[model samples]
Target: MKKVFGILFVAGMVAFASCTSATEATEDAAAAVDSAATAVDSAATAVVDSAATVVDSAAAAVK
Candidate 1:
């Protein structure tokens, strides 16, 4: 009976560790995705502004 109890206790602790680690991994993944999305959005805005500037320069040259 004592051996069974010890085994059960160890199993419970292992299960808890797995749950916490998984949750932390999920949170980390979400943060990385959010950071990447922000970077992409900023890049898109920069490209649009650059395109507009090019168009303006061309028009001025034509005039």
Candidate 2:
């Protein structure tokens, strides 16, 4: 009975540790995804700004 209790205790500890690590991994992945989205937004804004500048230059040339 003592041996059985010891084995169960060890198994429970391992399960709890695994669950904690899995949760941390999920959080890290979410953070990385958010960072990637911000980079994409910045790039899109730069492209739009460049297009507006080109349009302004063409208008000035016509004048």
Candidate 3:
């Protein structure tokens, strides 16, 4: 009976640890995706700003 209980306890702990590790991995993946999205957004904004500056310079030169 003692051996049986010990086996069950170890199994339960292993299951808990696996679940926790999986949860952490999922959270890390989501964070990485968010970071990538932020970087893309920043890059797009910079491109738009640079284009506007170019257009303005062209207009000034025309005048």
Best prediction by TM-score: 3
Taking all chains together, each candidate's TM-score versus the true structure is 0.59, 0.60, 0.62
What lDDT, from 0 to 1, does candidate 3 have?
A: 0.96
Per-model C-alpha RMSD? 5.0, 5.0, 5.4
Backbone clashes, candidate 1? 0
Residue-wise C-alpha lDDT for candidate 2, range 1-63, written one tens digit per residue:
999999999999999988765777899999999999999999999999999999999999999
Clashing pairs in 1: none
Candidate 2: deviation at residue 6, Å? 23
Worst 10 residues of 3 by lDDT: 17-26
For candidate 2, the lDDT comes to 0.96
In model 2, the worst 10-residue window by lDDT is 16-25
Residue-by-residue lDDT tens digits, candidate 3, 1-63? 999999999999999988765777889999999999999999999999999999999999999
Candidate 2 vs candidate 3, TM-score winner:
3
**Per-candidate local distance difference test:** 0.96, 0.96, 0.96
